[model samples]
Target: MKIKNSLVILLVMAFGVFLFQVYKQHQTQGSLNKTAAYYNTNTPDEVGASNVVTAIVVTYRGLDTLGEVTVLFLTAMIVGYILRHGGKEKPMKNNTSEILITAANVLIPGSIILGVYVFINGHLTPGGGFQGGAIIGTAITLMILADPLGSVKKAVLHITESLSGFTYILIGLAGLLFAGGFLDNRILPLGNLGNLLSAGAIPLIYSLIGLKVGTELSSIIASINETGNKTA
Candidate 1:
């Protein structure tokens, strides 16, 4: 009975959302649906970011970025808490084979470097905090596979997680207080188009995001390993 009721509620809400979207689309005039109508292609070139999507994700819709950060934070916290003492991982010093270790050593640094480039060039490219951060986390994963016993510390991870969260929130508050609105872009020099230092707060945010994801994933893996889920 509960399942049937829940399904009915979900179906009703889904149809309601579909109707709302259709109404919204119908409300917009045909010619007004052009890219220029919704977003500024001019902003990307002016901001020195090659990627318009990056500009949109990190700058124009930074509030959404904040939400994404919050979600990642929450996920890391929830998973960390759950797996911390849950008896789920196996921490063998030799959990990974020698070949995997060698490969990870070779690949990890390169991946981290690429992640940095992505964050630095986010405004002018397709990558940003979310994408770059995920890559950074991947590097940490490689480090773990290479040396399962190499000392993954929660203290360090906590610092990274906290600092990144603080940095993101501080920047947002600065934007709100100084830029006239929350997550405003005017806090830093907007920079020239296609330049490395362009995009102002966007790159800064991305860097922090990279750090956060890297540390969070590292900690999660460590927790899982420590807990007892040693399938790897």
Candidate 2:
């Protein structure tokens, strides 16, 4: 009881400190920091992306984005390895509802289309590769839930993931060789802003990212589901 009370008191104190910090925070002046000012003034003209956040993420901080994807890939690999080696017992099965199966059929196609749209237009819109990939993963999860015994082609997913990652790296190297730096978006002509083909290589890079992320996530989910299906 004393330990519980102590923990509660500590949590309360932390919350109080957070609240104090929030209260003490001052409103920003009209002026931006140097980096922000630079991006604001030059991003549209230089990056040719109306979406400043997309420009910064896909170009200015692209190497960091690559690291983030690599981390996710490692996580998925670890999960699959662990699950594959885990002990298997007699598998328990659950019956899925007809309504759920029907719903999956109705929604999966639209979800995939929306995911593709989001990544393809990452340079011009609010959504990007990660968001689109998550949507695709969700659709796969829904499909699994609707039919647990259904097979997902692991080979195809693996190939897609590998190819996308390879292509992404190639594009980065192209930027380093032909453009200003690694992962630069100016390897190709920056089309008119707000168009589907604008933002130079951003859309292509983001599409590759979406494919890699989607396949990785799906592979992880499929591994988990297969383990569950096979385990007793």
Candidate 3:
């Protein structure tokens, strides 16, 4: 019986490896289509948001962005729950000086602006919603690390994250219900590509993603630091 079980496990593992190989091949095939001229670059105007990738994320393949945000949210929730459960966090060191905090305060908004720029230009250039959102998340982490005492409110963070998630899904559903596909650009006016308002719902979705990433990352950082000072 034991040998039979071992053999079954080996077969399962081999099958899993085979599936992984197939997945890799499919991914390569998909990449080959990226440079194709039919790859949605025929926008009416230039993508308005700074990032070209953002356009691709929210406009062309928005479903993937939705899934990515869901993953981030689930990760944050799981990490917070795990860390909160008898898992004491070590107190964060107060190594950041006042000068550094002040500089962070000045730069946080700037970083956010730059992230928005990336999302806006996603179609015309390179960056997009996912990249810009990640940038914003990193910036928010810097703020939290620099000013642990002056952290953002948890209630606000929850609301921000929830709203962003809701807005993104609702927009997608609207497209599915009325428009063509899952992320069809119906509600948002598809302005000329390369222009500021181009790509319709793409900017809205990317901004939501950015907001959620920023708040979610900040919350994760706070979670670690929140209970670390427990009388140790």
* Best-matching candidate per lDDT: 2
Q: Any runs in candidate 3 off by more than 4 Å, and if so which?
A: 1-37, 40-55, 86-95
lDDT of each: 0.75, 0.91, 0.72
Query: Could you give the candidate ranking by TM-score, starting with the highest?
Result: 2, 1, 3
lDDT of 3 by residue, 172-231 (tens): 899888877787765666666566666677767766777788778868877776655443
Stretches off by above 4 angstroms in model 2 are 89-94
- Candidate 1: C-alpha lDDT: 0.75
Candidate achieving higher TM-score, 2 or 3? 2
List the candidates ranked by lDDT, beginning with the highest: 2, 1, 3
- Scanning candidate 2 in windows of ten residues, the lowest lDDT window is 85-94
lDDT value, residue 7 of candidate 2:
100
Q: Between the candidate structures 2 and 3, which one is better when assessed by lDDT?
A: 2
Poorest lDDT segment (10 consecutive residues) of candidate 1:
84-93
Candidate 2, residues 1-232, lDDT tens digits: the string is 9999999999999999999998889677788899999998999889999889989999999999999999988988899888887566555666899899899999999999999999998988899999999999998899889988766888888899999999999999999999999999999999898889988999999999999999899999998988887744
| Predicted structure with the largest TM-score when compared to the true one | 2
TM-score of 2: 0.92
**How well is each residue in 1-232 modelled by candidate 1, as lDDT tens digits?**
9999999999999999999998888754566346655565466544445677776676777788778777877887888788656643454446578789789888999999998887776676677766777788788777866766656678988897899889888998998888767776678887776777766777787788778877777777777655554443
